[model samples]
Target: MKEYLDLCQRIINEGKWIKNKRTGVRCLTIINAEFEYNVRDNQFPIITTRKGFYKSAIAELLGYLRGYDNAAQFREIGCNTWNDNANKNQDWLNNPYRKDKDDMGRIYGIQGRSWQRPNGSKFDQLKKIINNLKRGIDDRAEIITFFNPGEIEMGCLRPCMHTHTFSLLGETLYLTSYQRSCDVPLGLNFNQIHCFVLLMLMARFTNYIPGKAYHKIVNAHIYENQLPLLCNIQLKRKPFQSPSLIINPKIKKLEDIETWVSVDDFIIQGYRHHGAIKYPFTI
Candidate 1:
């Protein structure tokens, strides 16, 4: 992870800074990593020195995954990342195009229940992939997509913009995600780490031994305002530790079974370190 931080710093010193929708101005670039074979029990991709914007990130992710477009629920839970858009004068409250009329009408429910590809398919891709895994179908063809090109045009934040492919090889599954841009300090770094954790949980829910998730960040750029923070992150050193697993003995719905695979189980090695260092950012 130090290597990643160093590279990000070097890019900041030489890269261009530009304004982004999510975090003002940022330093952006393209990053590529090639792997010879599958790597197992690898270091989790999360940064340990600082809290990687977990609370808001998790709320936003759950809202998208569950298909809840409203920020009311998240705001009540101390999450306000989506409030900016949800509070706008776009009539999101009564938009007729909203597929789900109620809170249950979320992307997860729609995708898990009413999703169909353009070719007249009647199955939810995500659920189908999970069922296939339950039946022990280990192949590269088990990929599920969350990006809907049609929806992207209709004012929806592009779904699963980062994650592109998921493949199961034996008990371990490998994931490939593409990000056209990243806020290395504020958003992208944390998003990748959380998404990796989510994927691991999904793998365990389907009774597969959770292994390493290969995160491919294309066009990986850091925000200029966050360069100072990245430098401080690089200076920090900590040993990684294997994550511990937590399982719920009682299960009700399939969703509950899925939730039983706790995110806490997917631990980043050696993140426990000294107090937070001050890394101020100047745009």
Candidate 2:
């Protein structure tokens, strides 16, 4: 947790000022920021300075596993993160490929679960990885990526936390998550949990002990509207020890994850934090 706070402080001290034309909000930005979580210790890496929403983050990951491309599907499973991007994004609304309200298009889980193939057959990137991991196989290509250049224009928003590569060494499972862009105040909190939980789940299903989660961010920034709240309040707060998460033991396979898994199935223990400090989010 100190690393996260340090990253924030680094942005305040060393970040460059940049104007974002898309959101029309200026940002204090840093590049090539990275952090690691020792998942082997079972410590959940979350923003201890604020009351982070655990269910919402977990639900978003679960939705991605199920290949959900609709914002309504995200909401039904305790995640509303996609609502604004799906409904309010002007470009997505104007796109002909957008199916209806709450449609997120060909992004995230859609691409992970059913990537378009050359032969017209869909490729299940996640399934292949899971199957390989279960059999103690590491092909050195266990990756499920959400960033698809071919389908970027068909989606509501470009993926921030884009690629997750799983690796197996003996009986330990490690994760490397790559993010192209990071909204430090709001997005990093969710993304930290995403990376930790993802590694934990993959380890659980593959019968391997969870190891470390390494998160790499290309562009980390704090929006102009979010600066005061982050600097004046959040950055000033003290962070508690990282918490721990417990998953349903019965969920031992990818089928359980694909068929029916909710945020209710997961629990976080010993989460201590100050009151929630709402941060600004850009569409």
Against the correct fold, how does model 2 do in TM-score?
0.98
TM-score of 1: 0.68
Q: In the order shown, what is each candidate's alpha-carbon RMSD?
A: 5.3, 0.9
Best by lDDT: 2
Which runs in model 2 stand beyond 4 Å of their true positions?
none
Clashes of each: 12, 0
lDDT (10s digit) by residue, model 2, range 79-188:
99999999998988999999999999999999999999878799999989988998889989999999989889988888889999998889899999999999998989
